[model samples]
Target: MSDEHEHQHEMPATHEHQMGSSLSMAVAATLHCLTGCAIGEIAGLMIATAAGLGNGWSVVISIGLSFLFGYSLSTLPLVKVGVAPLAALSVVLAADTLSIAAMEVTDNLVMVLVPGAMNAGLVNVVFWVGMMISLTAAFLVAVPVNRWLLSRGKGHALTHEFHGMAAAESGWRRWLPSLPTGALVSVLIAFMLGGLVVSIADEAGWQHSSSAAATTRPAQDNPAALALR
Candidate 1:
């Protein structure tokens, strides 16, 4: 009877551990997705700004790149293990599309709502501040989405099986067992890239401003406009 009672007590502990593991995995998966989306979005916005594109075009580019990077990042690991390209793509799409879409929508909406954020030059502090806040909001919004999908064995849960298989085959299961570490690394890399892009954009903005000022005549210096007044 003691043994039976001990086993019963252990069962609840096992169940709780599994639940905790699932939640942690879900958070890791969501973070990974957010990192990819943030990298793509930032890169796209930087390019569009450099090219003098309008907000509409910038948003189009940002959304396109977000999906591309998000899908590619998630799919690459599967493909590396000899999964068929089509199957890998499908799995990535199934696992990450909703999460990516939700993040992008929330981020873009925040950017648009932030006064002058969409129009602010890269050198402007408002632009970077708004981007940071929007990304944070998007992360918060995506977490519950990932958790819900994970609970249903969808979203990132679909990819967990592949991760397990790959880890087992490559003997990485023992060394780097947790997915959260990998996810954190990805997020760090993305932020670093974003900072680099912002630096480049700031330098470019300064050059552009200087060149424009050097070539364009001041309004007060235009005698023809003065005569009309």
Candidate 2:
């Protein structure tokens, strides 16, 4: 056989190695998408629940923010490396939108199907439990999608092919904080929990103030009661 033909043929070992690396890349891509989704979904849900928005509005807000954050995570690094803002955004849009949409849909559907999950409060375990379940489902669903895209050289492959070199050359990565996959997920969870605690405290304090005001108002309204006390 000619040299080109020989080169095109890969041994089983090399094929297996490529497969392993591709699988790892797909998982990492899914996790990156997951982190962005987690931040947006939690923040949107919390804001929606706190404001008493209906389920429809909550989903809308969540999806909007998910796209915003997802595209942001991909786009920002490129922009920092001197990629034009719009070009970076366009690449990220093509690279991330489908994955993000799939994730958001899967997670939101889980939330809706879980009884009372949409209505659950920030402090409620039910809300958090549903969130965990939804996010896990999103991750599971997105992995295969990302894998398929990567195989076609359509997903993060696009990023690796374009602008990946510029980012390395610019040395912008050193200036940015890098979180491992597990640590990134942990940080997102901590953020959600911290918000939950702060919201619960604020609500409790407001309720207490309202109750005290109600008690004092009645005493002030009735001089006899005040005098008797």
Candidate 3:
């Protein structure tokens, strides 16, 4: 009778602990997705804006890059430990798609709703502020979604199982692998795009300012006019 009572008491504790662990795992997973989304979205936006692309094009590019980066980040860890390409892709798509979609929608909506955000220049304070606010809203919205999915053994729960199995098989070898090549490549590409955008914008801005100065200068101040005089 005492043993039965003890088992019953432990059952509730075990369930509670499992629930807590799942919640923590969900939060971590959501954050990982968010980080990738942020990197991709910001890079795309900067690139488009610097290149003088219209707002519609910028949004399209941003969303596309967000998905690419989010999926890449999600799958990289699985592939590093020798998960098959197709299986890793499937798991990442299943685990991160909804969360990434939710975040992208929330953040983009926020940006659209904020006055001047879409048209704001890369150097504008409004642009940075709007991005910060939108990303925060995205994070807030995604957390609940992730938690709900994880509790039901969906979303990141699927990835967690594979990760656990991999860990068991490889022990610490799982952790010893450097960052996945895909992730490193994605980041590098984003940086290159951002740098290209900055260079283009700087050149354009300088040309515009120089032309404006030339047009506004008094004829008396012009070298050609002075030489003629």
In model 1, which regions exceed 4 Å deviation? Answer: 1-15, 166-229
Which model scores highest in lDDT?
A: 2
Instruction: Determine which window of 10 residues in candidate 3 has minimal summed lDDT.
Output: 164-173
Kindly list the per-residue Cα lDDT of model 1 for residues 52-78, writing each as its tens digit.
999999999999998997887787677
162-223: candidate 3 lDDT, tens digit per residue: 66544324645465445543565466557545655675677689889999888868775889
The per-candidate count of clashes, in order, stands at 0, 0, 0
Worst 10 residues of 2 by lDDT: 165-174
Model 3 Cα displacement at 186 (Å)? 17
Clashes of 2: 0
Best by TM-score: 2
Better of 1 and 3 by lDDT: 1
By TM-score, the better pick of 2 and 3 is: 2
TM-score of 3: 0.69
RMSD of each: 7.5, 7.2, 7.2
